[model samples]
Target: MMLSARLLLAATALCCFATTFAISMDGFATGHKCRCLTTTSEVIPTRLFRRIEILAPGPHCGNIEILVTLKSNNVVCVSPDEKWIIELIARISRNRQQKKPEVFSADQHVLK
Candidate 1:
């Protein structure tokens, strides 16, 4: 009985944590420019660029990241990394804005 109770508490805590982290995203940005030939410079040998955007309204948020990697002047690779990045960004933003970080335990159920 004690073991089951503990497991239940842990699961609840994990779910809350995941939910908070998941809904925390605010926004993100991405851009690319010409790469310099110098040793200490950033650039792309070919014509490539990247753009990313985050759209959040009230309780709902979404992120779209596009990478244009040019194999040739015309050929490119456009890929989306992961859905977690937006969440991570939002969490960071929230953390920064808040005076202190709040952590909740599953054992202490607080209904939202």
Candidate 2:
């Protein structure tokens, strides 16, 4: 009777371990899928955007993802192929470049 009880406990423990491992593996496999389920081509004004994220294509997803967070606290995915989206990206890039601080040069320093 004691031997049978021991075997039953071992079987239960093994089943629990296998179930937990399978659940974790399933989550890991699905976590890499693309975040965007749909994209909009409608133009959203830059002024309304509070944040913008550009995600490059990876093994998990084959398309570039543009995610915008608006001032209203809403997140939207914009289509990368849209003309307005392209222009928005260019404008943002230019702005970022212009905002970079110029390196200090010794030649420009006034002799004290």
Candidate 3:
């Protein structure tokens, strides 16, 4: 009788562990799914953009994603292959490179 009880307890524990593992994997798979389903080639003016997010290709997504948030708080996915989009990305990169923070030197410090 004791042996039968031990076997049942072990089986229950194994089943619980398997169930937990399967549930965790389901959440993981859904969370890593790609954000963009369809993209547009239309070029939006830079001034209308409130924010721009560029996500590179990875295991989660096979293509580059360019998500632009407009001033109206709407998000649009733009095609990365578009010529104007490429130019816009290049311009943004150049601007970022040019706007490096200045390093402070001890000699430039002033006592207030």
Give TM per candidate.
0.22, 0.65, 0.65
lDDT of 1: 0.45
What is the number of backbone collisions in each predicted candidate, taken in the order shown?
A: 2, 0, 0
Q: Which ten residues in a row have the lowest lDDT in candidate 2?
A: 22-31
Models sorted by TM-score, best on top:
3, 2, 1
Off by over 4 Å in 1: 23-112
Q: Estimate candidate 2's RMSD in Å.
A: 7.3
**Residue range 10-104, candidate 3, lDDT tens digits:** 99999999888875343366567667899999879999999999999886776789899999999999988899999988998999999999888
| Residue-by-residue lDDT tens digits, candidate 2, 9-110 | 999999999888875343366567777889999989889999999999986677899999999999999999999999878987999999999797877986
lDDT of 3: 0.88
lDDT, residue 37, candidate 3: 91
Write down the lDDT of every candidate, Cα atoms only: 0.45, 0.88, 0.88
Report the lDDT tens digits of candidate 1 across residue range 58-103: 3222323333334443323222344444454576679888967678
TM-score of 1: 0.22
